[model samples]
Target: MRKTALLIAAAALLGSVSAQAAEQAIHIDRQPWSFAGPFGTYDRAQLQRGYRVYKEVCSTCHSMKLVAFRNLAQPGGPGFTEAQAKTVAAEYKINDGPNDKGEMFERAGRVTDYFPSPDPNEQAARARFNGSLPPDLSVIAKARGVESGVLRGILNMFTQYQEGGPDYIYAYLTGYGKPPAGEELTPTQHWNSVFPGHKTQMPPPLTDGQVEYTDGTPATVSQYARDVSAFLMWAAEPHLEARKRIGFQVMIFLIVLAGLAYYTKKKVWADLH
Candidate 1:
């Protein structure tokens, strides 16, 4: 009888704990991920495809306002060439020279100029965002910690770009979901990611297999997410490759030293034993 009671108690305790865990744990549900490469590096073709998607589909509403044309051709960048980068820059006009007469006016873009930000300052930005502000995406992949190694660094670049997607950028871009079972959304309130408390104002950005891809990588929503995430990762941390190389050397040295220490300890302890 006592054992039965104890078992019942244990089961109840476990159930309670599970319920609490479910309630308290915030599931980011990091949209599903496939290994881009061994450690997370994406293929060049994937990155380019994602860029095309961004140019064709995504850039319409959100702004990549901080990057520059030259950055495209920079080391560890999109690996674009100077001519290609310049052409891309020319496609988007940035404020440049003074307009008619002596007065200044918005002019075309140059390779050196950074992308324009959506807002001039924080207050205006927040007002536009419903007391929230969209972040600058230049370093978002890296800032979000996807730039751990060569593959991860590349993959993290676009971690914010896909669905089954839990990230803010992804959520922000592909906004809209029905409200919970009973609760209702106000006309203006968007259903938020389960993490943050807001319905995304941004609308769904892609149709299934919306992006035209030549690489023959899967063209599913998940693949699109992964590819874009990788691109974003690269954007966020351009020097991660170099950093990864240095870290690898340091890790190798530390491992060798640990082995040496273990052997020396064994030798020293042998006499006592």
Candidate 2:
């Protein structure tokens, strides 16, 4: 069986779909996303803001199944106080156990609990998204669409192309389609992407200065999206810091091992040669 990595952990929450604005599709104005050699790490401040953004903005319709509140205080994060985490955790609750009559009970979440999802399973997600499953964000950065490098998106026999790299994500988010003033939206072209490309369903989830990044990060719309995307990527893969550290240690040991092998080979070959 193919192993679909589902536990990577990630972000976003949806709201009432009825709240969407009129179908005004905007064109892709500029390239925005990049991944290769990206300099997108969320220092403590950015993560804190990103966390706030997720909770206040994106948590309604989506779910983050992998992260618990306690993870916030790790090596390179906001380090929320236990009291702070509990306050945040109490915002949601889950089924605790059963009553004598066999009904489920409820309790506020502790920092140790995973996030409560809006829906129970894929069927619920599809029902919520008009039949499209909202992809889990845990590993979305790595699960990047192949067309991520294309400036517009994958070659559509129908429309323009995507620019490659992180700009792909950047363009897609900002690319909400705007009708040409006169034309009404066709059902096919109805929903506008905040990013330029129509392939994305997410609206522009950021605003100028919506998030206060004390890390001196830019507060532009695109900058917020980029930072939050990076933040989500890191949350989905919290082991990355340890992974990087281990990789460095392994590489050093291999280098030393290689040097020893080379010297032994030279010593053995000296008499034979």
Candidate 3:
């Protein structure tokens, strides 16, 4: 009877501790994404819309340095045609090199050129944004870490929940709203519920009707967030589909080879047995 009471007391203590932790923890909302599971592929239209959001809104502060202009036309990516990509590239002026006069000059960007930085250097970027530098968006989606607790990890393994990056991006982008009544914000800080500690250096960048979507999708902030997040994910993992396909093929090959080996061994051992 004493041992049973002790076990019950321990259980109640654990329950109270868990309840307190839950009350103190920040909850990040998960967004629905197309490219989330093992067999997932990017939505081409959505990627294009995302690219538009990036070009019009996010590009003002963030540089996608890792992606070249030509990558837009690559297969299993944003599905931009060669002509379309070239047209897009022509919109930006790229720094080009030494001519007969051995002087650097500006030229229309080509497929070979990487996306240019808005600011000349880190110092300039920081100064422009009130001592807070805007991060390069090329891999920002991948850079954000997922808050996968023990229970979430087990659930994700079965659910194939690989949208942590994009989901976090979407949540964070849409998370900006009016602060709580008593919450005080510094002059340079903006309130974002999804952000760590609920404060961010960057202001809310997106608003309704910010970018005109060519495909007639709604220009709401929510849509913009989702599309841009998806685009960033594709930029970070351009070869994702190809990698998955190759991995699947390898698994199939191994299975077939194993079956053949098993049959051959059985045949060889039949006489000995």
TM-scores for the candidates: 0.64, 0.65, 0.88
lDDT of each: 0.62, 0.58, 0.88
Candidate that scores best on TM-score: 3
Q: Where does candidate 2 stray beyond 4 Å?
A: 1-42, 76-78, 81-83, 99-101, 120-125, 145-168, 179-199, 209-219
Q: CA shift at 233, candidate 2, in angstroms?
A: 0.8
In candidate 3, what are the lDDT values of residues 103-158, reduced to their tens digit? 99999999888888888789998889988889998888889856766578799889
Q: How many Å off is the CA of 179 in candidate 1?
A: 2.1
Give the Å shift of residue 138 in candidate 2.
2.3
lDDT of candidate 1 over 176-232, digit per residue (tens) = 456778777665466755425555554456666787787677766655655676667
Ten residues in sequence with the least summed lDDT for candidate 1:
32-41
lDDT of predicted model 1: 0.62
lDDT of 1 at 30: 51
Model 1 vs truth, CA RMSD: 7.2
Tell me model 3's lDDT, rounded to 2 decimals. Answer: 0.88
- Give one digit per residue, the lDDT tens place, for model 2 in 1-273: 223333222111122222242143343343332212223234555567667666655666667887777776565456577788888888777787688888898988888888777788889888877776666655555555333223333444334222232344445554455655665654434444433343444545567877666668777776666655555656766655556567668979999999999999999999994
Best-performing candidate as measured by lDDT: 3
TM-score of 2: 0.65
